[model samples]
Structure formats: structure tokens, C-alpha cells
Target: MKNTSALFIIDDVIANQLLELDDEYIGYQVLHEESFYKHLLDVQEFPVIDEYSNKESHKALLVIRSWQEVREILKEVQKEKNINAWKRLFPCQLYADGAYGEDTIIQNLSCAERLLIRAVQEQKYVMFYC
Candidate 1:
């Protein structure tokens, strides 16, 4: 498995799941408004860019806005990365509050999958995800 460092700007639920999936993976959880702003500042400066990591390690930045927007963003990011098969190696979810809880989240994910497939077919990178 490729080891990667990922940055997630998500809610408590998604962040908890990600941590549970991999204890070794280091990341920050921005669940509050102040923390979110702080995270944006950090991203602009790119503090983690110089941090040490292995060649196989991958770094990702996940920003979870609203439930609807998060899915759109994820689809874009997946397209940009050209990722397929939904491998657990780089598992990260941008989750937010939707009407139907997990069901809505899953539906959103399906949309992201479709976008991913289209991106793969066209060999195009979605710019907003970056």
C-alpha cells in the first residue's frame, strides 16, 4: 500500500472515520469556523509542503463545505487525481450534513463516482478540486 499524508477539512464524523481507518495517518480536523479559517491560511502558506514523507506517501487536502458542495468537490478532486476503483490506500471523505444522513452521503458519492469515470474517459483534470 502506498503511504500518503492527507489534509482533511471536514466535520467531526468524517474526520473520526478517517482516523479510525488509519492510525498512522497524520491530519488535522477543522470542525469549527475559526479552525476552518485557520486551515485556509495554512493551506495558502502551504506549511506541510516541506514536511518529510516517503516517496510512496501521498498528500491530499480535503475541504468539506456543505453536503452538496462537498460531493461536487470530491468528484472534481478524484478527476484531477485520475483515481479509480475507490481503493482504500487513499481513503478520504468530504462529509457534511445532508437531509437523509448516510443515505444522502452515499448518493452524493455515486455522483462523484460518475464524474470520476467521465474524467478518466476524457483524461481531463477538474481544476476546482485542486
Candidate 2:
């Protein structure tokens, strides 16, 4: 049960570190990137946690994408069954915080999904990592 999760950041590595985080990134967030229930299944990526990560050496710009790109990737995730299953498993998303069920458990995995939605709606690229 590794502390796997994703979220939005200020696009500043230093800030990410100050918050006691690791692997600050930006992009579609593959875990959040949906698929059609094929070639993808894992216990990671979800639960909107921007203030509760365990990583202590974090924050860095890993990927950058335009609003258009972000939307496209998010659209892909919308088709993936794994992503939906995660949400269904955690109706109360926050329950996912500090939660673990499978060999590959990631706390707050749903956060990536929420972050993607917000980024798309705002038409802005957000920093994320897991």
C-alpha cells in the first residue's frame, strides 16, 4: 500500500516541497486519463486530497499541457472503467484518504479526477503527480 495519489499544485517546485510533497507534476495525469476498460487496471489514482499527502520531498514540474490537451486527456479518462470503479468504490471520496484495499493502494487517488475537472473548466494547466 504505497502512498500513491495525485493533485494540483502552484507550478512551483519550491512551494510543492514546502508543503512536504514529492513528485509535483502537470499533465493529463495518466491515472486520471480514462480508458475503455481495456489494458488498464490498478489500485491507484483518486480521492481529492490536496492537503494530505505523505511524501515529504516533493514538488517539480514534470509535465506541461495546454488547456486543449488537458481536456483531451481527461476525455480519455472518462471512458476508462477503472477510473469510474475507483469513484464507485469510494462514494465518500475522502474515505479514500489513508485508505488501502489492494496491493497497490494510493491514498486520495480520486483527487486527480477532481483536479482534472477543475483544470478543464478553468481552462488552465495544473500541476499533478502520484
Expressed as tens digits, the lDDT of each residue in 1-130 for candidate 1 is 1221222333444434434544443333322345333432111111121222232234334322333443454554543243332322223332211322444434444544554444344433321111
Could you tell me which residue pairs clash in candidate 1? 3-57, 4-58
Shift of residue 52 alpha carbon in model 2, Å: 10
Query: Which runs of model 2 end up more than 4 angstroms from their true locations?
Result: 1-61, 79-107
Cα RMSD (Å) per model?
A: 15.5, 13.6
For all candidates in order, the CA lDDT equals 0.33, 0.42
Task: Give the CA lDDT, 0 to 100, for residue 46 in model 2.
Answer: 48
lDDT of 2 by residue, 1-130 (tens): 2344433333334323334435344323433433311222223444343233443234223333455666766665542345544443223433355544542333344445565667678655443333
**Using lDDT as the measure, which candidate wins?**
2
